[model samples]
Target chain A: MRLQFILSEIGIGLRRNLSMTISVILVTFVSLTFVGAAILTQGQIQKFKGEWYDKVEITVYLCPRDSTVPSCADGEATQEHINQIEQVLESPEVSPEIREVMFESKDDAWVAFERNFSDRWWFTEMSVDDMNASFRIKLTDPEEYQVINEVLTGRAGVEEVRDQREIYEPLFDVLTKATLVASGLAGVMLLAAVLLITTTIRLSALSRRRETGIMRLVGASTLFIQLPFMLEGAIAATVGALLACVALWGGVHYLVEGWLGQNMDWIPYVTTGDVLMVAPWLIIVAILLAAISSIVTLSRYTKV
Target chain B: MIRFDNVTKVYARGARPALNDLTVEIERGEFVFLVGASGSGKSTFLRLTLREEKATSGRVLVAGQDLTALSNWKVPAMRRKIGAVFQDFRLLPNKTVFENVAFALQVIGKPKHHILTTVPETLDMVGLAGKEKRRPHELSGGEQQRVAIARAFVNRPDILLCDEPTGNLDPTTSLGIMRLLDRINRTGTTVVMATHDDEIVDQMRKRVIELQTGELVRDQSRGVYGSSR
Candidate 1:
C-alpha cells in the first residue's frame, strides 16, 4: 500500500510538471550521450593503437640503382653492400630486438609500384631500376623501434629508416583530442543537467506545498513526503539515460560500424557492443544526477 | 495528555517570546479551548503542543513525551500519535474525500486492508460517507472542513489538536463542527482547540485558557470565554 501510494504520488508529480520533466529528460539524454561517446571513442582509439601498433614495422629503404641520395652515394649497392646490411640486420645482437626481417628485391618493389601508380602514365613508363630494394624489419616491440633505427640508418646501402607508427601518430592525436573535447563538454552538460533536475524538483515541491503541509499535519514522516519527489526526478533522468543509450547504439551501429567501417575497412571502429559496454555507466550517472539533485533540494521543501 | 512546563518560545532573538514562562496541563480526555486575540500566543500554544516549534528555554510535553527533548527523527513517530487540523481546511485539492482520509493512514505505514476498512468508516463518522468520491473543491466549505477533520481523526490519535477548524465556516456550520468535536471528545480523545469563537466557547462551557501578550491571563475550568475579553 505504501508503495502504491508513493507510486501514485510520483505519477501525479510528473504529470503536474510535464514540460519540466521533458526538459530534464532531454538534458540528461544529451549529457549522457556525450559521456558515452567520449568513453567509446577512447576505447576505439585504444583498440586501433593495440591492433595496428602490433603490426607496425620499421622499413629500411636500401640503395637503388642510379640513386643520388647521399646515404647511397657509394653508388648502386653491390651484393657485398646488400650482404653486409642483411648480415647486420640478422646478427644475434639485432635479431633479439627484431621479430622477422623480410627482404624486398627490386622486382618485388617494381610490382607494388606498378599496381599502385598504374593510373599515372608518367609513373608506369619508368623501369624497376627506380624502385628501391628494401629490408622490412618487424620489431619484437614497437616501442623499441629507435634501437633498430640506430643500427640501420646511415649505413652504406641504407637510404632511410622509418617506424610505421609515426605515420599514424597524428591521426591518433586528433582522435584523442576529439575525445578530450567531448569529455569536457560532457562534464559541463552534466553539471547543467544536475542543476536543472534540482530546479525542477524544487518547483514541483513548491507547487505542492499545501499537500506536503497537510501530509505533515496528518503525521506523515519526512521520507514519506519526499519520496514521491525523489522518484519523480529519478524517473526523468533514467528515461533520459535510456534515450542516450539508444542514440549511442544507433550512432555506433550505423555511423561507425556501418559507414566508416565500410569506407575504411582497415581502421577498426567502435561497434554496438562498445555502446552496450558504456550503457550501464550512463544509467548509473543518470541515477546519481537525480539522487544528488534530490538530496540537495528536497530537505528544505519537504522537511517536517 | 499535554503539558507545558515553564515553556518560552522565541521565534527571533531579542524579540517578544511567543509563550513566556508558561506552565499548563490538560488531562487525557479533557476538551480545552485556547482563546486570545491575534499575537496573544494562542497559535504558539498549539504549535508548541505539536512541537512544530521548539521552546527556546523550557519543556513542552505531549502524550507523555518531552517534545523539547525529542530528536528530529522521533518527531514523526510522536506526531503519529497526535492529529492536527487547520482553519482553512487544509485538504489536498485534487484528492477525493476518501483519499484525503486514507492518506493519513498510508503515510503512517498502515496496511491496505486496514486503510480500506477504516477510511470509509471514519468518513462516515464525520458525516461524509456518501461524499467520499468528491474532491475538496467540489465540496461545500463545511464539507471540506469535515474531510479535514476526518483526516485528522482517522488515525485514532491520543490527542486531536484543532487550530480553528471552523474558522472558514458559517455560524451554523461552526456549530455543527463544534457538535462533532463534542462527540469526538466523548470518545475518550483529548482535544485542544485554539479559536477566536467567543460564541462557541461560551455556549460549549468547557475549560478555556486565555492568553494576552504571551502570558496566560486566565485558566477557567468550565468557564465562559469572557474573563480576558
Candidate 2:
C-alpha cells in the first residue's frame, strides 16, 4: 500500500476514536510531566553541587586563651600567630592547593555579630573579646578538603576545623531522594499508561471487527491491517508528551526557580536556565514512550 | 479446481457434525450453485474452501493446496487466489467505492500502476464505473452489491466464493448481480455460490449441490432448484 493511503487510514481511525485518543494523550501528558519534573530536579541538584563546591571553604577557629605556643603565648592570637598560620598557608608544599587565605580577628568577629544582630536584644551584652578569631581558607581543589582539615585540626593555635561538605551532603541527600521518588512514580504511571493504551487499541479493533475481517479476507497483510491503529496510539501519545513539556517548563519557571531565586540568592545555585536545559530531553522522552507503547500493543493484540 | 476427499468437520463437544464423511469435486470454469435452507451446512461448505473453517479429518483442497494442512501464514496467500463476496457486502463504510475496489488489489501487493488501471476496468465491468467516488452509504442496494462484486473480481482470482451475493436485493437487482457473476464465470474463473433464491438457480441451469442437515443430498449438472426432492 502507498504511504499516503496508510497515513490517511490512520488519520481516520484517530478521528473516529476521538475520545479514546484524548484519554491516551492525557495519560501520556501526566506521566511524562512527572518524568520531566524528576529530570529537572536531578539537573538542578547537579548544578547546585557544582556551584557550591567551587566556593566551599574550610574554616579553622584558633584557641582563644591558651597563649602557650609562639604567637598565642603573648595572650590571645598576636600578630605572630596570624603570621604563623599565614606561613603554613603560603608554604611551597601546600601553596598549590591553597588559592587564598582570609583572616578574622576577635574584633572583626564581634563586628560581624553586631552587624548581623544589632537590632536583637540578646546581642546587647556581647563583647569583642568574647569571640574567637578564625581563618577561612579557599582550596584550589575542593575535593582535597579532607587533606586540609587533617593538616589544620591539631595545629598549635587551632581550636576546631569544619568543612562545608558536611552540610551540603545532607541537602543533596534529600534532593536525590526526591528525584528517585518522582522517577519511580513516573515509571509506574508509564506502565499503567501502556496497559491502558493496549486496552484502548483492542477495543478500537473490536469495534471495527467487520472492516478488519474484510481486509483479512481480501489478503491484507498483518502489518497493513495494523498500521493505522498503531499510528493512532502514537499520535495520541505524542500530543500528551508535548503537553507535559509545556507543563514542566511553566511549573519550574514560575514555581521552584522563580520563588527560590528571588528569596535565596545566598544559596548560590537556583536558576531558570537549569529547568530550560532539561526541556528538550522531556519532549524526546514523551515521543519515545508513546511510540514504544503503541508498537508493543499492536504487535501483541492485532496479530490475528 | 476444488476437491473434498472424505471431508468431515466436527465441532468439539457437539453431537452433530458440520460436514460428514463426504466427497465432492468442483471443476475449474464451472459455475456451481450450492442450495439448501438455513442451517443445512451450505455456508460451512463455502467456508471450508475459503479456509475460514477447516475439516476435522479429511483432505480439503483448493487451487491445488490442501487447506487442512496449510499453515496459518500461508492462508492469506491462498485467499489471494480466491475472492470471497460476503452477504453483508462488507464494504468499508469510511472508504469511497474507488477505494473499496482498490483494496482487493492493494491487499495482493499490486503496484499503484496496476491498481489505477485495474480498479476502474473492474468497476466498468460491473457497470459502476461512474460511481467510483461515492461511499457505500451513498449508493443503493444494487450498487453496493455491484461494488462488492467489482472488488471480488478486481484481483482476477482463479475462483470466487460468494455467500448469498444477492440475498438482500430485490428480484431485478438480484438478476443484475447474477448476470455479472455469469459474465465473470464465462471468462474462465470458477464460481461457487450459496443461495436460497429458487428462481436464479433454475434459470441459470448450472451444476447444483443441495445440502440437508449437514449432508450432501444431491449433486447434479444442469440441475433445477427443487428437483433434488
Candidate 3:
C-alpha cells in the first residue's frame, strides 16, 4: 500500500512539473552523451596506438655522393663505413634491441621512389644516383628510438636518424586534445544538470507543502515523505541517460561503423558494445545526481 | 495522557514567551478544551504536545514519553500515537476523501487489506460513507473538516489534538464537528482542543483551561467559556 501511494505521488509530481522535468531530461542526456563520446575517443586513440606503433621503424639514412651534411664531407659512403655500420647492427650487445634489419641500396630506393611518384612530372628529374641508401631497423620496443638514434647518428656515413612514430605524433595529439575538450564540456553540462534537478525538486516540494505538512501531522517519517520527490528526479534522469545511450548507439552505428568503417577499414572504431558498457554507468551517475540534489533540497524543504 | 510541567515557549530572542511556566495534565479518555485569545498560548500548547516546538525551560510529555528527550529520528514514531486536526482542513487537494483518509494509514505502513477495510469504516463513522469519491473542494466546509477528522482518527491514536478545528465552519457546521469530536472522545481517545468559540465551550460543558498572555489563568470542571477569568 505504501509503495502504491509513493508511486502515485511520483506520477502526480512529474505531471505537475512537466516542463522542468523535460529540461532535466534533456540536460542529463546531452551531458552524458559528451561523457560517452569522451570515453569512446580515448578507446579509439588506444586502438590506433596498438595497431600502428608496432610497425614503426627507425631509419638510418646514409649520405650520397652529392650530400652537403658535414658528416658526409668526404662524399658518398665508402664500403668500409658501410661494413662498420653493418657490424654494429649485428653486434651481440644490440641484437636484443633490433627485431629485424633491412639494407636498401640507392638502386632499390630509386625503384620505390619511381613506383610512388612515376605519375608526377618531378619523376623525370630524379635518377638512381640521386637516391640515398638507408638501413631500416625495427626495434623490439618502438619507444626505444632515442637509444638507436644516438647509436647511429653522427657516424661517418650517416646523414640522419628518424623514427616513424614522429610522423604519427601530430595525429595522436589532435585526438587526445579532442578527448579533453569533450570531457570539459561534459563537466560543465553535468553541473547544469545538477542545479536544474535541485530546482525541480525544490519547486515540486514547495508546491506540495500542504500535503507534506498533513503527512507530517499524521506521523509520516521524513523518508516516507521525501521518497516520492527523490524518485521523481531519479526517474527523469534515468530517462535522460537512456536517451543518451540511444544517441551514442546511433552515432556509433551510422557515423562510425556504417560510414567511417566502410571508408577507413584499417582504423578500429568503437562499437555499440562500447556504448552498452557505458550505459549502466550513466544510469548510476544519474541516480547519484538525483540522490545528492534531493538530499540537500529535502533537508531544507521537507524537514519532517 | 498528556502532561505539561511548567512548560515555557519563547519564539524570538527577546519577545515574551508563548507559553509561560504553564503546568497542566489530562488523563486517559478525558475531553479538555484550551480557550484563550489569539496570543494566549493555546496553539502553542497544542504545538508543544506535538513536539513541533521545544519548550523554553520545562518539559512536555505525551503518552508518557518525554518529548524533550526524544531524538529527531524517533519523533515520527512518537507522533503515530497521536492524531492532529487543524483549522484549515489540510487535505491533499488532488486526492478523494477516501484517499485522504487512507493516506494516514498508508503512511504508517499499514497493509493493503487493512487500509481498504479501515478507511471506509472510518469514513462511515465521520458521516462521509457515500462521499468517499468527492474531492475536498467538492465537499462542504463541514464535510472537509470531517475528512480531516476521519484521517486523524483512523489510526486509532491514543490522543487527539485539535487547534481550532471548527474555526472556519458556520455555527451549525461547527456544532456538527463538535458532536463528532464528542463522539470520538467517548471512544476513550484523550482529546485536547484549543478554540475561541464561546458557545461550543459552554454547550459542551467539558473541562476548560483558559490562558491569558501566555499564562494559565483558570482550569474548571464542566466549565463555561466566560466563567474563567
Give per-residue CA lDDT, model 3, range A235-277, as digits (tens).
9999999999999999999999999999989877889988898
Ranking by DockQ: 3, 1, 2
Which scores higher on TM-score, 2 or 3?
3
Give the DockQ-based CAPRI class for model 1.
medium
| Count of steric clashes across candidates, in order | 0, 2, 0
Order by TM-score, highest first:
3, 1, 2
* Per-model B-chain TM-score: 0.98, 0.97, 0.98
Please give the RMSD of candidate 1 to the true structure: 2.8
After superposition on all CA atoms, what RMSD does each candidate show versus the true structure? Answer: 2.8, 5.6, 2.7
lDDT of 2 by residue, B89-207 (tens): 98989889999999777755788999999999999999997899999999999899999989988889999999998899999989989999999999999999999999999999999
Backbone-clash count (model 2): 2
1 or 3, greater by TM-score: 3
Task: For residue A29, give model 3's deviation from the true position in Å.
Answer: 0.8
Candidate 1 positional error at B23, Å: 2.2
CAPRI-style grade of the A/B interface in model 2: acceptable
Best by TM-score: 3
- Report the number of the highest-lDDT candidate: 3
TM-score of candidate 3 chain A against the true chain A: 0.88
